[model samples]
Target: MSTLTAVNPLTTLERRALQSISTSDGNMLIVAADQRNSMKAVIKDAPNGSDAITREELIEVKADLVRHLANHGPAILLDPEVAVPYVVDEGVIARDTALVVGLDASGAETVDGLKYTRFVPGVTPRTVRDLGGGVAKMLYYTRPDRQGTDSRIFAEMRDLIAECNAEGVLLIVELLTYQLEGESDEDYAAAFAGLVADGAALAVRAGAKILKLQYPGSAEASAAVTEAAQGVPWAVLSAGVDHETFIGQVATAVANGASGAMAGRSLWKDSLSYDATLREELLTGRALPRLRELADAVDGRRG
Candidate 1:
């Protein structure tokens, strides 16, 4: 647990929602299946997969993940387009697992080399609550190194936060930084940590109570993010790194004051397949073990 004090008190419902999605010890281990375009790319690249990925196929993949992994975590993050409602209605998710619905659209629009976030139409905090989701997640792309780049998005986020507060839904604001066109990879890597910390600070200033952020380069940077959060309970996102790498990142982040982890591809990417039997085997043998390792990392039980 972080020693930093919370700046704002959580509302009754917000506190309940947070508790519902977290372990008894107050750490969160959230499995993320909210991906859309990236998931389609995976499906398309599968050995037996066709060029055209169907909605049913996507739902099946998500269902398999939920059936196999939901029981191992306190919450699962799903998107409104495919996973939401379907997973809940089918009862594939574990009864004890809480649902978090992603409000962002499938992909972002790149304008002048910067990515802009878009929300799924009609997917708001109230609608998420109506859909039986205990929390709402909104992913926003930011360029903290570039001044004034995220002013509009921050304004929109403030409105969303107010709406969530009014509806009594806890919102987890997820921040992702992107490299601009023509920027050198080395420069981007060097600035990555500060960008994440600055982005977290910006979100906190915009009234974010909870956050999901990318790995901030190193342990010291992770501590910087914790400081920027001001006790808002930030979690580290996997960013599609390999499972082993993600585990190390999670371990470092948690040790440096991250609340826990929110991961998707790092846990289940290789387990995806068209063959049901093979998929099950891979999920059980590969993904489940990875999930356990991640959970252990979150709880500080890993050797």
Candidate 2:
């Protein structure tokens, strides 16, 4: 939806936003507690009487989440600007981490006055630079090619990403890579490559700042190390029902090219009946002793 004639790299604020991403400092994890996963944390006290969490309860939990994350040092991403206050009510998110939109990175409509946003439509780097678009970011989507088109959807997205670059917007491509299982590991890896190649092409042609690449489904073996953060920042699942299932996903993210992960359900769901501190521990990977150990090590480095 951009109307720029020439393309360019992201602007200053855009770059700052992109560089602000961290999986641990509490800036980019999906933390809203009203949805299905309740961001993995149960909502024992929703004042609104609806599934959507209330500000008061969020205020209480957010502080605890931040403290837990500070000790662990990771950023979490939540949706709806209304929740922005929870992250920065006291200027915490503004001071400690980066936040990305946690909306439906797959749609552009609204429900119950809630805009189910997937991408930031009608915006570009020029808009951010010339217009009042400000330091806005975008979320890209992936999955089985919809609308009967080919995987060329990536290329089409590449062009749009170019426009977003010129408009000073950050385009983060989400990873709905494959149908999980029934495919070979090599095929899955190639799919990830294809996704990255699309992002790299867009960056080279124009200059988008971030690549929200998700990992391959068939092989959840790459996301936990330097390999995961290879091309750009990527998002990983909060967790799967199984233990090895989630760890494998994190491992793949690290192996491919991901600096951090944004997780929800796995952390919160299991903590439904637990106390806030214990819930915090679970979300920070304490439930899984190995994960908690890893978090402590990461925190040690930052300290």
Candidate 3:
């Protein structure tokens, strides 16, 4: 991580957008329900897989998630496809809770086992603002250890950053690292922290203002990410880990310097079900507590 300074001060609109998605104390607790294909896969793999689930069913799931979880956090991440216009128009999300729309496509294309990101057609920072969203999120795959692995993606990211700045919307650049082809599991695990730290630095250099990063594997690595961010606020993503594991990660991360968390599956994976009544029970009984716990973890360490 370098000690370089930010390129410029945030625009007034950008500053307000950032405030809209954070607590009064300035910590961020974002509930991410923006998954598309992954959520569909979860629904399809259920025992009942009797019929192909329709888009309405997926929207219902997303609505249920937003209905149950959005108010508990400062912000919620929803995709433009099923969740955004529907959730916003229907008022499923609370008025006070900020909305973050994901701009990336559901799943990435793979070439030689390396994943590449694709954006949803016609979605941009301006599109997010037009949707009444305060934040726009873009997820990209990277391998920081290998130079030029994602140069094209990096270029796109730079362009998006410029667009977001011009549009006066806050952009949260999310970095996801994958195990490369022919890499051993052990080696991948060993290199996880470095990859995350380097990836964050790379994003920051690309002019990312806010970051949603994978848990960097240790307290030391977490601190490195904060250092790499150079005072730009960053929140650790849950990455589908269980609630208990994610709680520990949030604790270590915020204690070191993370602003908060942006989590999805970890907070509500088991709560999802086709049975509406049962889903409510699990979301209320299991997921809500996890959200509160994670929020407490972040708030407790607030500076």
Candidate 4:
């Protein structure tokens, strides 16, 4: 077991989720399709550029992706609103695949010039557990140089941690960065590495057991982020970067101590333009292969 697994120790629920998600080598290949508005945007802007889709089409597309992706032994992150319930009801998710549910309703736009994520008003840890989710996920906006925790964000995370603990489920906290108003792109760029490292450290300090963090820019930087984590198991998020770029990022992260990856867009974005059959083919052909390659990369580092 890893130091975090030993020190914190997994509850039965947490262990079940972890076991379902992790390969025998204890590395993971997590397919994150839990996007909300971002997913809609992909569909809207698909190749033809003007295709109209019904609610059913959106739900089906997500559901199919979940089903197909799960077959490759990857844990899937799905939105509770449409994807999770549908797949669970239809028995589409494989029994051995871990199911993680998104607990936030998020958009691509910033709120008051700051980017952040909040719990969807009605969703709770218990509700997600009841919906067959083994893990509940939430994303938080953070910056590298920030002093103290944003009181509201801290309070929200604390409550969420407590709830998930009580409900016997795992929590995966994702930390992200957005440029604040008046900050130059150059300034944010300079701080990007610090943001990835320090932001992850902050989340770990906030009691996050499983962290989803950005790649911290390079292998050397990733090592710094890992050290700051102090042995907490963390995975890198793809952040909508292109596939080849993300593949390199994942390899670098794992080599530098990241446990695995929790990525979305890079895996399936290209397939959005195709029909259902072609989409599934693309998922199996393109996405699954990439996930397996990443999984192998993670396991290689483990060895």
Candidate 5:
């Protein structure tokens, strides 16, 4: 199947960013840890965790993830609030490691099982570049059904895409779906494919260079999403699923034409139960092996 040509030719910087994030073989294995308010919530609920954490602690935790994990080769995604600043200033990011800065805000509220996301002001592609970010990433929720439409979000995405293109920065757009009111589990299951495909199509049309998306149930459904992506590089997000399930999804997504994965929680969320030292140990011991498995999966597909 033929893929669509990029709306704008990839700039040298964009190409460099893509290469830095991917393996030497050009297979992506980006590890997304850029959760803001959500991270706080996770930390709060973690076993032996705190209800409230200092900004310093947050930075330490995120920095630890980069220190231990990002060095392993997968590109790292970080939030602008504390993680990005800490990583860049402290030189936690290695020269070869790809650095992605999160541009979205932290106020995603659930309305009847559906999520409504709003963009936070202040972080732009230019700011991301200035902060030494190789790629600027934004995560937003969308649905195939019109009832989930947010014109403001779409408009923001368009502007961000234009800005990234003009500024020579790579943009990674993450498309997630939510359950709407009166929608049963069966209804959601039925609409999953169209939602994933439609969301990818919309992001590509808005000029996303790379898309971070949910798995569309099966390889066949994922193929339709790949078809809709029109040649733009797309990766599967973990969505907090267990490591095994996510690994399978990554393999399936790549077999069906996805480039690779931009996953978060599934990779390291399990390691959140211990103190700093033990946390790092569990993350390094447990998470690294999982990533290695994923990398192998991607490599197999590329082969």
Candidate 6:
């Protein structure tokens, strides 16, 4: 498809109407698009009836996927910069224009640990750069506990962000807290908020603008979001599970003073039927009504 068609999508834009929502500084609502974060996919022989996928073919798939997502309406595009450029180099699919979001996180570490040098080897040195002169941002995901700050990992993040500089790259962060699967929603939200605040503070001091952190669950979630975002220019809340859940969550985030949101599975998990309907709503300005309703529901309910 032509770049014009991909971006303008003459048909309609209910999904693209995202900017009309709420914003801070320059709020951005994005959708995370990645089937796998495996830096290098371990190729394997496929069973009969399966088509072989060459590295070039995989690059094409990645590019096309990006194009498809770009049409969905996102001010910021989240993905590992290193992997994205690989596809661009192949010319299979070149979404040369996008706001880059870089995330560096690990499994068993604390907030401070991420600030140091110890990190999952594969996710080190999170960096962001300009793609087609648009905007670029980077964020280092880390745990909050001082013990969690691994020397190697944090050092990598510190160096990478500092080197990226301004004019081309914007770096911020998101911190995950609690065992996502085991903690209570409230506790989980508290942990997430505390960690987000810690990371947000660090990122801003170094020139980062947005903090893409966990979704605070309820009022506490709102408070955490508010607290973490204190003095920060902007923030993007993590995506939730479904449209309803995401809307509610986003509403809370906005109330907590978030500028926009970054959603993934929650936005694309629906059938094509839903996409068409949602798209139309955005183009016609009809979704604003619904957004208001959502905002009402989300108030004081961030967890």
Best by TM-score: 1
Candidate 5 lDDT by residue in tens digits, 1-303? 113465545677777778888876687778888886566666644454554676787788888888787678658988888887778889888777788888888768775555666555788788887888868888878865663235555666778889888887888898888777888999888888898899888777676778889999898998999888888888888988998998888888888888888878888877654268887887789988888888877765422
TM-score of each: 0.94, 0.54, 0.92, 0.90, 0.90, 0.57
Runs of candidate 6 with Cα error greater than 4 angstroms are 1-25, 34-58, 72-83, 86-97, 101-139, 147-157, 178-190, 205-207, 237-240, 269-303
What TM-score does prediction 4 earn?
A: 0.90
lDDT tens readout by residue for model 1, 130-235: 8888799999998866644257767877889999999888999999998889999999988889999999988888899999999997899999999988889999
Task: Per model, state how many residue pairs clash.
Answer: 0, 52, 0, 0, 1, 38
lDDT for each candidate structure: 0.85, 0.43, 0.83, 0.76, 0.78, 0.43
**What's the C-alpha lDDT at position 125 in model 1?**
88
RMSD of each: 1.9, 8.6, 3.0, 2.6, 3.0, 10.5
238, model 1: CA deviation in Å? 0.3
Clashes by residue pair, model 5: 4-230
User: Clash pairs of candidate 3?
Assistant: none
lDDT of 1: 0.85
* Of 1 and 3, the candidate ranking higher by lDDT: 1
- Comparison by TM-score, 1 against 6, better one: 1
The prediction achieving the highest lDDT against the true structure is 1
Give the local distance difference test score of model 6: 0.43
Models sorted by TM-score, best on top: 1, 3, 4, 5, 6, 2
For residues 72-101, write the lDDT of model 4, one tens digit per residue.
765889887778688899988887788888
* Pick by lDDT: 3 or 4, better one: 3
